[model samples]
Target: MTISLSKDEERDFDREIRPLAADPRCQRMKRFIQHGRITTYEHSMNVAREAFRLNREWHAGADERRLITAAFLHDYFLYDWHTHGDRLHGYHHPRIAAENAGRDFRVSARTQKIIRSHMWPLTLFHVPTSREAWLVTLADKICSARETLFERGSGAGHR
Candidate 1:
């Protein structure tokens, strides 16, 4: 079953994501698929929500703004990786995402690290070096598994 956010959670989520969401480039993700059955927009939303929840509930001492922004931007690469098959998406998308984010937003170095390293073990050497980066990485994996396995129907990009 799908979980719905409370009003307060929804408000906070909207507030935190407003800057990124306001951009047409980021908004276009609503049409791009990620994982198996979710849009990149949905997948990134899940990661940002979970990363915020973990930081708030667990008191991870990470920079809250950076965590939320980076989580949202961690998959901001604009293409459907499934169709663009020349390279391994998992191994390379983080860097591409970081580049896109840097171009589209005023990202801090920590935010860049968070985006570049969220792929974690898949990327090997691109390790998460900050508390925020670690949270984003873990949250991304969790959200990815849920999107890939539990969600239904491929997103609009496949069609």
Candidate 2:
């Protein structure tokens, strides 16, 4: 079955996702994007889009809301991992993102787990248990890494 959001459903998605994107915790992310550093919004959208692509390609029957929510908010912490001092982001940001997400959104248990465990083999120490969670995690990594690399290359000669 091909599932796609209608215009009204897309509007609802924007309404639901925008508040989280506008939160104070997420402000740092917005600022980064505004400064042409890297875009949390774009990165997030890419992850969600990529996840949907993967699902369509693999014919994976995943919950669309859970997958999209997890993909969009996976890096809700909005901190620059490169400046974490001791590289704590690999082991810390997931918890921070999860806590903030819990406070801001009525996240499902599975969605929360995906947010909390997306940093697998690092802080999570375990892989995501659900297909939706796993898809979000993989999408997050793919998007984040690509963005990070692009930013690094573009900024290499400037700094």
Candidate 3:
């Protein structure tokens, strides 16, 4: 089931994400599918929402802005990985997304690291080192698994 934010939560989330959402580059994610029929934009928003919920539930005291930003931009690599799947997209996307976030958003070193490390043991060396990084990493895994497993079309032809 899809999650819905409360009225107050929606206000807070919109405030936090509005600046990024206004950018055409970020908006372009609507055209790229991340899993099943879910667009990258939708997946990123879900990851951000889940990360925020996890942080609150665990009382993790992570920086909210940093956590949300990193979560939403974690897959900001800007290309359709499917048509151009080189087998390295899984291993390389974190780095590419981090670079794009840094360049486009001027994110902090901490935020960039959080984005870079979201792929975790899959990337081996790029382990999450901060509260926010770990939150985004776990949230990414949760959202990706949900989309890849429970989404429509019989789980056919997805990354």
Candidate 4:
């Protein structure tokens, strides 16, 4: 069964989500929301929502605030990976996002580490240690893959 958040829970999400989504970097991300490419905003929201679902399933005691924040900002680097004309995104985007997040927001050390290590065992060369980080990593891959498939016009067959 799917768990649904209560009205108050959704209110809490709006409080935090609105501010972050309004941030300048995220505003830039919004422009790509309909660029015929999978957007950062869409990817970030999907990851957060999926991670929240997974957290609920595991009965994990992770802080919801941190999990949402990390997932939403995980792809804050805001570049089109395809247009980069290189595969450097697999190696570079996380660090770029972490640095920008550090500068633009008052993020926790844990959150920063989550962002920096989200590409783990690939770009990071190590697996994440925190429960939230692991959740975000898994959610990122799941959401990104789905979005990629959707963008490729193979959504019906793939799903």
Candidate 5:
């Protein structure tokens, strides 16, 4: 679950991603745990940071601003889904996140699409239709898997 960025990457993160991620509501995500030992805020930062690195490495044509913004807001469901009593959290959080992000930030349609489709395959019909969306999806899975499988119990808490 460690987000390892080089100096230049850190500069990129600070310059490109930190401002929006510093939003008050976004900061509140620090209170909620995502997978295993990571806070939702930490997880979102990891995703966005990684997405930016990937975009640089791959020249993937994904819009950097949109990708970072969407990554930060992809899990903006704003609650601990594990304890929310929602039976369909996996299928539903993406849309909830999309709505909340749009309402709060006036994100573009492309960013909304990235947030709404990041949990694809589990979300089934909501396939990623853009390069940025696909990168967010892949980054989410990688970060989630690493957090859940390799970093479990360091700070894990029960719902």
Candidate 6:
């Protein structure tokens, strides 16, 4: 989890990550628990950071801005799905998130598509079509598995 970032890379990350991370609507994600103790905001950040790193490390020629933006907004469904909203959260949230992203962020069609496909086979028909989408999907599963299994310590309380 501790990837060494060069100064240039750090700057690039900040440049790409800061605005969306700082958005008040995005900030609202801190109110919802995602994994055991992790906030959706934190989870989204993990996914975005990991996907960005993977894009560079794997030399996956994804557009950095689109990749980073889509990754952060992939889970932008803006609800506490565990307690409320649709029971089939897994199957529907990607579409909701993508819609929210489109309305609020005016993301490109490709970026919206990436956000929509992050859930992959669980979503079945909404398969990821681009390297960027696949990278976000992979990073999301990796971060979620780690958080769901390991971050559920007794001390980590829901806000």
Question: Per-residue error at 120 for model 3, in Å?
Answer: 0.5
Q: In model 2, state the lDDT of residue 132.
A: 85
Ranking by lDDT: 6, 3, 5, 1, 4, 2
Candidate 2 residue runs with Cα over 4 Å from true position? 1-28, 33-36, 83-86, 152-159
Question: Which ranges in model 5 have alpha carbons more than 4 Å from their true place?
Answer: 152-159
Give the alpha carbon lDDT tens digit for every residue of 18-104 in model 4. 888877767787655423455677667777777877787788877888998998988888667667665777788888887777878
Q: Model 4 off-target regions past 4 Å?
A: 1-9, 33-36, 152-159
Clashing pairs in 6: none
**How many residue pairs of model 3 clash at the backbone?**
0
Question: Candidate 4: worst 10 consecutive residues by lDDT?
Answer: 150-159
Candidate 1 lDDT over 74-101, as tens digits, reads: 9999898889884788888999999988
RMSD of each: 3.4, 5.8, 3.7, 4.0, 3.2, 3.0
Q: Against the hidden reference, what TM-scores do the models get?
A: 0.88, 0.71, 0.91, 0.81, 0.91, 0.91
* Better candidate by lDDT, 3 or 4: 3
Q: Write the per-residue lDDT of candidate 3 for residues 1-159, one digit (tens) a residue.
A: 355677886788789988887789899988899888888998998899899888877999999899999999999999999987678999999999999999999999899999999999899999999999999999999989988877743234545
Q: Please, what is the whole-model Cα lDDT of each candidate in the order they appear?
A: 0.84, 0.68, 0.88, 0.75, 0.86, 0.89
lDDT of 5 by residue, 16-118 (tens): 7778877898998888888766789888988898888888789898878898999989999999988999999989999999999999999988789999999
Candidate 2 has its poorest 10 consecutive residues by lDDT at: 150-159
Model 2 lDDT, residue 65, Cα:
73
Output the lDDT of residue 54, model 6.
90
lDDT of 6: 0.89
Model 2 has an lDDT value of: 0.68
lDDT at residue 96 of model 3 (Cα atoms):
94
